[model samples]
Target: MKKIILSISFIFTFVICFAAIVADLTGTWKGLIKFGDQKLELTYKLKAEGEKLTGSIVSSYGEIPLTDGKIAGSDFSYKIDIGGGPQESKGKFMGDSIQITSTFGGNSVTNTFKRVAEK
Candidate 1:
């Protein structure tokens, strides 16, 4: 009986830690993406349901809808269709920041987003 109780406690602790890591990323984030001399401000609103993520991006140019976003462990992948063109980006989410790398128009760019306090 004691052995069973200890095993259950260990399993419960592991499950809680996993859920916390996943939930750490579900929120609204804002940042900037710079490519050469051009820069754009971006807002990302993310909703995570289980392992699936759905969100939208708003920028100075326009709003792009995100679809089929998913998170596996600490990595995230998502696709966005903007103005009839599809672009995909993948990155890792660190505690207060996310490092994203993508290619647009054959040019590769890296963007890092820092979390801002909600007002």
Candidate 2:
């Protein structure tokens, strides 16, 4: 029926638009986290292929590989083990800002990331 066809078209369009928004996370993000006065600068570089995200974190320690990254809508979750134990992060995107909550070493730290400006 006409109504059914229209409904499917609308759903498809919405899904494509949402996927584009999720893909926008691909690139470099920089943020600083403070742990009791010890502040560290971190950079995240992400790549999107379909709903899977591949990226790495760069800090003073070096580059840390991100594992099992996946995205749905505007939310994403990934894991990495650095220094201590396995760290898990859940991130949400708002405009040009990314808010992430990372948990590791029995503590959780939340940081805001801004997209790196391109030359």
Candidate 3:
């Protein structure tokens, strides 16, 4: 009986930890970029398979594929090509929001994204 109880406890702990990790940024997200006095809204559709992530960004410029996407704990990072310019972004997930810092064309930009419900 004691052994069974211990096994069940371990399973329960594992499930809780796994769910917590998966719950962070496991869906579509939308954000806006602000540079100096200019702002542009963008949408990111993301899918996570295990520790690997796949996504794309939709902006007025066009759709860009997210490459080399990875996630560790609450930290996430990815790279994308926007109009022939390579850019990389990294951030931490908090609740339903993620704050990311991206560098492009020798300029660093910060953005805050909110998780969007899938249609």
List lDDT for all candidates, in order: 0.80, 0.88, 0.82
Residue 88 miss distance in model 1 (angstroms): 1.8
Question: How are the candidates ranked when ordered by lDDT, highest leading?
Answer: 2, 3, 1
Q: How accurate is candidate 2 locally (lDDT)?
A: 0.88
Q: Which candidate tops lDDT? A: 2
In candidate 1, which residue pairs get closer than 3 Å at backbone N, Cα or C atoms, i.e. clash?
Answer: none
Task: Tell me how many clashing residue pairs each candidate has.
Answer: 0, 0, 0
lDDT of 3 at 46: 79
Give per-residue lDDT, candidate 2, residue 52.
89
Residue-pair clash count for candidate 1: 0
TM-score (C-alpha) between model 2 and the true structure:
0.91
Candidate 3 has its poorest 10 consecutive residues by lDDT at 17-26
Model 1, residue 55: C-alpha shift (Å):
0.9
For candidate 3, report its TM-score.
Answer: 0.79
Tell how far residue 26 is off in model 1, in angstroms.
1.3
Q: Give the per-residue lDDT digits (tens) of candidate 1, residues 1-119.
A: 99999999999998887677678777777888876798889888777666887888888778777877988877888888765577888878798887778777787778887766667
Residue 15 in model 1: lDDT: 80
